[model samples]
Target: MLCAYTKLGMMVDARHLFDSMGERNSMSWTTMVAGYANIGDMKAAKEFYDLMNENNAVAWVSMIAGYGKCGEVGTARRVFDEVVVPDASSWAAMESCYAQKDMRQKLLSYIQANEENVDGTDATVWGFFIRCL
Candidate 1:
């Protein structure tokens, strides 16, 4: 229901339903974050993201994409930096954001610097960079 409301752009109802819930799982938290982010409500998304006990890739990617959509690439990078262990989706989201914003040099520099930190053998991670190039 919360997901449905959020998907329909009915955040007010979604929030009401979310707030009334006694227990929230990661999916519930992520749904709110994604919903808020999808609507360009980064403040709300960030608030929910901060409240999440265990940050998942979906929520992290959502925040990055949301900031990118708002033209806050720097902030998106900050969110990306916060990921402890970014998955392929997170890398793809950040790389796509950088590409869309024409930050090629930054993207190359970022990829170069971060590649050493990422699993050098993870093809999915490497694939995003390859596609970016």
Candidate 2:
């Protein structure tokens, strides 16, 4: 119900329903974070994300992609950079967003800075870079 309302752009209603829940899980929190991000409400998204005690790739990706989707690519890139050792999925998510935005130069610049972590010798990583272009 909360997700439905949020998807429908009824954040007020979504919040009301969310607050009424007796117990919450990662899905519940991620839903709100994704919802706010989808609407370009990065502030709200960040607030909800910060409230979470734990985060998985899905939660973090939501924020990275959300910032990109909102044209706040720098913020997205910053989030990606903050991860000491971003896994393949995390790197792929943000890089894909840059590709979608035609920000290939920015992506390439990131690759230059983080080559050690990106597994430059991996064919799959090369595949991702090719696909991005």
* Leading candidate by lDDT: 1
| Candidate 2 per-residue lDDT over residues 1-133, each given as its tens digit | 8889878878888888889999999999998988888888999999999999887677688889889888787889877776666767777778777887888777777777778787777675676667656
- Candidate 1: C-alpha RMSD to true structure equals 1.5
**TM-score, cand. 2:** 0.81
| Residue 114 in model 1: lDDT | 76
Candidate 1 segments exceeding 4 Å error: none
Tens-digit lDDT track for model 1 on 1-133?
Answer: 9999989979999999999999999999999999999999999999999999999899999999999999899999999999998877888788878878988568768878877678878887667667657
Q: What is the number of backbone collisions in each predicted candidate, taken in the order shown? A: 0, 0
> RMSD in Å for candidate 2, one decimal?
2.4
What lDDT score belongs to each candidate, Candidate 1 first? 0.89, 0.81
Q: By summed lDDT, which 10 consecutive residues of candidate 2 come out lowest?
A: 124-133
Off by over 4 Å in 2: 84-89, 120-124, 131-133
Error of 2 at 80 (Å): 1.5
- Models 1 onward score TM values of 0.91, 0.81
